[model samples]
Target: MASEFISSDIVSILLFMSPGFLTIALVGKLYGIAIEMEQFEKTVWSLIASIPIGIMFVYLNEINSIDSFLNCFLVHPLRSTFEIIVFSLILALLVSLIIQHKYLENLSMKLIHNKDDGFQTDRTVWDRFMQKNIGKAAIVETHNSVYKGWLSANSSRKEKREIVLDSPVIVYVHENGNTEDFPYGKQIILFGEDIKSITILEED
Candidate 1:
């Protein structure tokens, strides 16, 4: 009789703990996406928020299976616990996906807007220029007007600082109260006024 009681108690504990364990596993999977601890920590907090749901599942499964020994045949407590855990995992995953998607969307919007009024440049101009021409490339020319090598703006920062343009490409142009293309790696000499524009010539 004592052995039977021990078995039942073990089964009961397993049945109750499964849902919370499943929740932690699901959250851990999402945290593996990026190593941002802030985001991962927030996700763990969200998992904790679902503990009440897990407790409810555990209570329901235990109560439903308490009566008969043959209850294990028709209504398996462990199986019911797993089912509830799976449901909670799905819900938590969906919520995490939605939050991640929103964050990406907001970041994309900020990149496109480029809200520095001094430049007055918008996304449409940026898109049009990039479509017609490849991304900003630093063209180095010798003082004798000879073409040197081309360097892409996306290149490493160390590479960018090493670039030098000859006299022709290194002219000083005024903003003239008009929006200009904000090219990458182009040096802007902002006098007393703030930097208002940038333009990069198409690489031939």
Candidate 2:
């Protein structure tokens, strides 16, 4: 009977943490954040977040305290759980927007004395360049050829490093110093290993 009671308590604690996990996932998607953490670490962080969320919900709903909320949750599980779920969704979305817009970061920069202009939010140079110049006309230079087309998509992985170009025309220079252009109607996928340099063309 004691073992069964402990198991039930464990289950209840896990169930209470579900909203936190859901909020984390929602925030990641909406904010475009890459949550790089192990499952155990994520669970611990979620549990920490869940406690505050529950407290906030209790206060907002005019509940007496955490004890009252827990009692209501136990007595009316379905309705209370649904309300928590809805509140979590809204909270997650708001948090995601805050991260995405970098409002806090900007505020900090203004308040703090930081004059270094080298700071960038993107993880990599490729990401920064692509964010500003995606879908523009570009020239891709390979070892033996040059490809001119509109830049489509690029992979985020540094190891893979693949890029796609739309309606590319490959220019090959022969041994005779004659250049021949072969226009491909379909898109071309180029590996980073084969690419020598990429230049984004400006608006005419």
Candidate 3:
């Protein structure tokens, strides 16, 4: 009988406690994109953090009492659910903030941002320039050729190795500074594998 009771308690903890901690991390996201971490690692860390917080929540609420003792599922099932959710949310937000500031910066390693502005992100000089010059004309210089076009702002992802251009006019720059647009379609895609530099052209 004692072994059965202990097994039931263990099952209850596994079923409720595991998902309870996961809910906390999801709530902490505030409907934003979740951080790029391994799902297994995230869950493990969340559960480890949540255990003590869950205990504190139970102690504070005093939900466990003789009244609910007959309910072998948990000391106070309904109230415990509420406690888990609230505590998980609080801990989730706290841990997310710690990881954002203490562990990783905005997106890239070589980026600068204004702390006062929530959306002010400044990465490398080239990236900042591209962001500011979106829809404007620019020249993408590669190892063997150049492509001129309006910079597509959405071309770059944090770790992507390629970029996109709209209304592209492929051209080659001569040593004497002469340029002639090549016969090609309006759209051009360039890979960082061969790109040497990006120059924002003054002409429209």
Best by TM-score: 2
Alpha carbon lDDT of residue 126, candidate 3?
Answer: 58
Backbone clashes for every candidate come to 1, 0, 1
Error of 3 at 179 (Å): 2.7
Q: Give the candidate order by descending TM-score.
A: 2, 3, 1
lDDT of 3 at 196: 96
The lDDT of model 1 is 0.47
Model 3 vs. true fold: TM: 0.53
Q: Every model's Cα RMSD, please?
A: 12.7, 6.1, 7.7
**Could you give candidate 1's per-residue lDDT for residues 1-204 as a string of tens digits?**
989877876765554444555655565677455333455655565456456655565465554544342354247757754667677677657656765778756765566566664444234543444334334443333333222123232222122222222222343235785433323343421221222333455656
In the range 1-204, model 3's lDDT, one tens digit per residue, is: 989777766665574466455655564575466556567867776677757665666467553843222243355678666666676677667656756674554453333554444544424555666677887888888888778887775444466556778888779668999977875576778877788988888863
Name the 10 consecutive residues with the lowest summed lDDT in model 3.
65-74
Stretches of candidate 3 exceeding 4 Å from the true structure: 1-20, 24-35, 39-73, 86-111, 114-133, 153-158, 172-177, 202-204
Give the lowest summed-lDDT range of ten residues in model 1: 188-197
Model 2, 108-138: lDDT tens digits are: 5554434475554424667657756889999
